[model samples]
Target chain A: MRNLIWIGFWGLFVLHQDFWYWNDATLCFGFLPIGLAWHVGFSLACSLFWMAAMKFAWPEEIEAWAAESTER
Target chain B: MEYLSFYIVVGYLALLIVLGLVSKFYSRGTSADFFVVSRTVGPVLLLLSVFGTTMTGFALVGSTGKAYTSGIGVYGLMASWAGLMHSVVFFIVGIRLWAIGKKYGYLTQCEFFRERFASPALAYLLFVILVLLVIPYLLVGVISAGKFLQGATIGMFPDLFGLPPLVLPDGTERQHPLHGSIPPEWGGLLICLVVLFYVFVGGLRGAVWANAFQTVVFMVCGVLAFYLISQRLGGFARATEMVAISPFASNRLVREGNMTQLYFLSYGLIPLSVGMFPHLFQHWLTARSAKSFRLTVIGHPVFVMIVWLPCILIGVWGAAYLGPLATGQNPNMILGRMVKELVDSQILSGLVTAGVLAAIMSSLDSQFVCLGTMFTSDIVLRLSRRTYSDEQKIMLGRIFIVAVVAVTYGLSLLLKDVALVFDLGIWCFSGFAGLFPIVFAALYWRRTTKAGAIAATLAVAVSWSILFYRDMLSDKPPGSDELTLFGVLPVTAIFLLSVLAIVVVSLITSPPSANTLRKFFPDERLSRR
Candidate 1:
């Protein structure tokens, strides 16, 4: 399982290089050049938003984390 | 320029004082609130706070300076984000760390390490390293402010030494000319004072909140600076075209043996440093959730893309624009050089200058707080076993902050090279990178005994010690860099070596007591096997 996680995690690391090259000016969002900052920024924002929404929406995990809260 | 200099520095100081006082309302009650802001730091502020420290004058002034001098190569600093989050085992395996830290009431990295490893000697050793390493980081902030402020305010104070001829504040032809070709002692002192004021009054919480505020200033200002500069060059396309056409841009990474090795090695080295930087992880532990941790990290690559593109642009811009100076001498002055050449508004220049100083102070103050608190929480408290009153310890923390600042400033004063200045940050971070495996394994793996932890700590210490001895005994620069051998970015080598040592020793040694294992890994033990 740890090995699987390692593979999954670091595989993403390789993918990240594509996301984070010095210049990916070839990128085309429709007819426009989204520009490097906007392209990278909006994508990251959308991904984080979706993931966060999913986490908060999960009833069981929310309840469990709530139960664990302030116990310290 | 004189009036503008006074207004910028003085006005900014007053605003910070007021902001510091206003933040005092948040500082009331329990030391926890005072130190960690009740861990109420939200995502934006948390991001900013982390950026505040992480980006610093080094990122703004030093790295840009390097970019100006070194061609597009230093932009690799930005490409470094992919590895930054890889080092974030504390966020993943570190859910266990939060539980343990809360349970034991441990604060700072060394405190947690000492208790978990159950070794006093290890704790002391770690604390000394933390103190030594933090000095360089603090200097990044101090030295950057010195350079920027001096350049920005040069003619304002021309005849202080009873000399008749005043050196005009020229944006002399380097990459970041404001970065005093000579280290500016007074500017370092002034910047140090601003950092000391808030950090002294409010401690870590104050430092972090200010960092949070400053992060935005640096990031936005950074983007704006690049955007404006690129506009002049007709944006990145023209900029990259300019660099590609320039003769100075090296194909060294492709052709040279050392550069090839370094390019790959940097991925591992930088990841380890980012993973274990005590300041970055402190933010990780304070997060609202593990999912939040994940989401926050998603921003890193994007942030890297945003932040570094400009730097590479700036570096190449410097390489192309610097003309005669490109043959020899530092190119890191590109941003400052360009600012003088391109940015003309008095208010705009002042704001930009302030933003640059904020970047330095933000990073420096937090680093100081981290170093001070680490010493107080980890070393002092460990040796005394929490013998001192909380108040006494807080005082000790403040004193440590002041002491570390003085030492780092002294070093920056002594060493005036751009390579040396930037090297300080990398050197400290590399030392901490060696500790990451032990930190993560202790958090996640139940079989990771105290013996394993002890072995890991000692292994890293001795390994680095041998490297250090080699530095002293041998004439050649250590490690494998085309520029110089043993150039202090050996993250992959260190991580693999440490991981192998810990796993082998753990396998040979008695496993951790069940109680100890339970204390760390908890609910997952049943799920594991």
Candidate 2:
């Protein structure tokens, strides 16, 4: 799960570069520019990736330790 | 109808004041309550305040103007990069900072630094550098608010504030309608006073409450403005199609051969500035639990897209509808001008004005409160060596807030002519980005020494200063397209140098004491505890 999360993180970073779309001015969804449309998808992907990260890769032990320290 | 926008803006200000007074009723009057809301902020308010502070007038006004000149590529340059990078920072850096801050009751970044490295000198240096950088940032919001109001309310008070008519290229004279309305200085002053009142009365609590309210207002109004303007130009599809074919702005729809791939990539470094923003650091500490960051980390990117898409699109469309801007025109006013020209309902116009004010003031209130917190906790309390009472500390903080507000407002008035909101804001963010290496090292690197931290801080400050002076302040400052070094943004170079300095210095210098390492690294200690 952690490795998958890491892969997703880098994948998003690589996909965000979108060099092929730089010159593609074709409109998507009637009005959205191809480049702009690409990013709207990128933004949604980021949200989902982060949600998965919180569920799988969150530093639970560290947080538990901090809470324990407060109690002590 | 002419003064309708102005009246709505005034009402919005009144609402903020009422929110502040109401927050004061709940405040415990302790220094902790005033500074970090006693570290009890829930997830929703935390998300809104952090998101609101990040957006500012730069997102709404400056972005539209930048999009006008640069085209649709503006969205790719900053918005998309910010949408992704900010969430990464919040999840990784923010959660840790919140945990440590809650453990130690840290109210400001410098306070954490002071304890982490056991170096007051480094903390003081960072405090000075942060204040210097933040003033320009505050100026961006102030200048944008003033310009937005001035452009929105033009001709509303024509008898009182009318200017001479402008001669067009076609030999026709157009009346300067802004003649009898609120001037930029007055607009800036009103915003400054209103922010000062709320921050003075309610402190960080008031700022956060108002930020949540303001965030909702701007997002709704932003979409409304986008929809109304698209309709005014034609339908959304037709509006964009016209620009795609028009001689004046067809080039804006594409980025081929103009913006370099390296340059577009360098913008990824700019949003790293949020990692080092003192205001954001303070906001992070206000979370009630480490899990409180979950919503912020997940929701931030979508919120950024929601706010930025409209502003960026409106800006791109401006080039087609408004044609070319006249000489000496501030691009920051393009968003306002489009609304005034196209969106004709007085009530709708007033709503838009209030929305812009909400975005601008939401940021200003937090920054004012943050600076005051820094001054009181990091500087005055540390230097004076006196155990002052809670009331006295709060009073001192309010006084410093007033002083900082005064200085920022005065500078905003003087720079009305020179301020380019987008460019100036980018430069400020670059400086902050350059400082991110220090903070990251502080949190994650067990071997990072106080000396390395100081060296990295100095390296970022010195490099940022030299680049800014050469590129922006020099008598022959480079044009926008020419500001890069070897075709890459200066932020990339500055960030690299700071990272290099920290790594080399840390390896060469004596490592931190075992006790210091244990406290920060804490895995062993965690198991023992």
Candidate 3:
């Protein structure tokens, strides 16, 4: 499950970055150009993807080491 | 208004001095306390300092200027890429480095490479390359501070210096408007001295504390500046509409004409340089625990969005409102000019100028302290066979800090019109990114050999030097297409070559000894055996 999540996260990065919107002329919400608006959404999605990584993909042993060090 | 802004900047500097002096109370009078705050920094301070250090003057002044010229593609090239990749670095590289640093009591990036590769010479090689790259990065901050101050205090000291206006041989008088104000040289010197005083007084603790305070000031004032500028050109919607309807509207949306898809994608690699930054290594080690990294990783992206969104939008708006930037005028002055023109209140403008300077100084202090720490720990202590007292260590660090500040400030003055802040910054970051593959391999791949690390460093150095020379010779204007190979950034070529060198050399050479593998990869069950 964790590996799948990591793969999904990377996939999102590659997909968002493919430059598909390079020729698009549409503006989003009457202000941002379509390409930039896509990135703003992509940025928000990346934040969540990382949050999931923190919860699921964080190295457990590092946490254990940190805990032990603080206890000392 | 210019007088008011100058006073506000003075007040901000005074406040930083106070913070620096007060930080001494927390110092236990040891080199460890001075260098890394005895590794006791909490999550909030760590997040702020790390973010502040990464932002630099490039984010505020350079991004706005580039966006003014190149349009919204500036965000795609850097800010958006940084927003994601910076957090990834914090998670993958930062946490592991913190663990190793605490375990081994490593003080600098070179110290880690030295012990891991078991080659003292590798440490020296890495130090020289890192310092060479970092000095230009330091210069970016200094030059931007000088330029911003010169722009902010325009007309404040008109004709006071009595310097005659420059004239061309063709008999045209050069427009020398800001010549009478605090020149970039003097303003740059003032910023250097203030940053040096703080880092010299309280060391890393003072730097981290100042970063936290300055980060808050800049972010708040940055948003205010954005709002005021947009309101001045009509509301946000109307301002953007004006930009959208302009003939250059396509530039506002996409990278127009001759910009390749690959070149834009290659910028994603640049933020990975954060993994190899010596200052960031020092910052990572200061974490009280690995848990301190959690907040940094989770919140950094959002924080990046908050700071960058405003600056990027304002720059795009400047395309339509400000019109073509005057020929030979520095684009870095655009943000200051926008604040001066749009904001009515002198007090507000002063506050905003103070905020911008705060952002610049926050990064400057960290770089100063990190350079000093590396010099004392990596060079003086490691190379010397004799033991030194803590007082000696502290003294060496202070002396090196002063030396680095002097060198960088001198270069800033000498090369006042050398390059735009963004252009020079991209080159510096690219050099560091070229080195990132080695650091990544060192942490994750136990087979990484000492020879492999040496080869990777050499590959980056040779490639980066050639490209830098070519860039200097070409003397292309800012926002022009950088010399690229197959439409990809020069960094892509350097990074690929570096990784290839590391992998192929490590495969041919003897792998690291079992003892070394056991030490770095302590969690591996076989390594424990």
Question: What are the TM-scores, per candidate, against the unseen true structure?
Answer: 0.81, 0.95, 0.94
Looking only at chain A, give the TM-score of model 3 against the true structure.
Answer: 0.76
Give lDDT tens digits, candidate 1, residues B190-274: 7777777787777767777787677666677778887777777776666556655566642211113212334544544554555
The alpha-carbon lDDT assigned to residue B93 of candidate 1 equals 44
Predictions ranked by TM-score, top down? 2, 3, 1
Residues A1-72 of candidate 3 have per-residue lDDT tens digits of 678776976897686574678767577887777777877777788788878887877777875654434212
Each prediction's number of clashing residue pairs: 16, 7, 0
Q: DockQ for the candidate 2 complex?
A: 0.64
Give the whole-model CA lDDT for all candidates, comma-separated. Answer: 0.59, 0.86, 0.84
Which tens-of-lDDT digit does each residue in B1-529 have in candidate 3? 4477678778888999999999988788899888999999999999999999888866777778888877777777887788888888888889989988887788999988998999988999999999988888888888878877877776677666434678989998875776666888988999999999988989999999999989998898889899888788888778888887788543665665525577788889999999988998999999998888988988888888888888888888877777777788877777877876777667777877788888889888989999999888887887789998999899999999999999999888888887644477878889999999999999999889999999999999999888877775657768865677778888998999999999999999999987788777747633355
- Clash list (residue pairs), candidate 2: B155-B177, B157-B180, B161-B179, B161-B180, B162-B179, B162-B180, B163-B179
| TM-score for chain A, prediction 2 | 0.86
Candidate 1's displacement at residue B33, Å, is 2.0
Model 3 pairs whose backbones collide: none
lDDT, residue A67, candidate 1: 30
Two-way lDDT contest, 1 vs 3, winner: 3
lDDT of 1: 0.59
Output the number of the lDDT-best candidate: 2
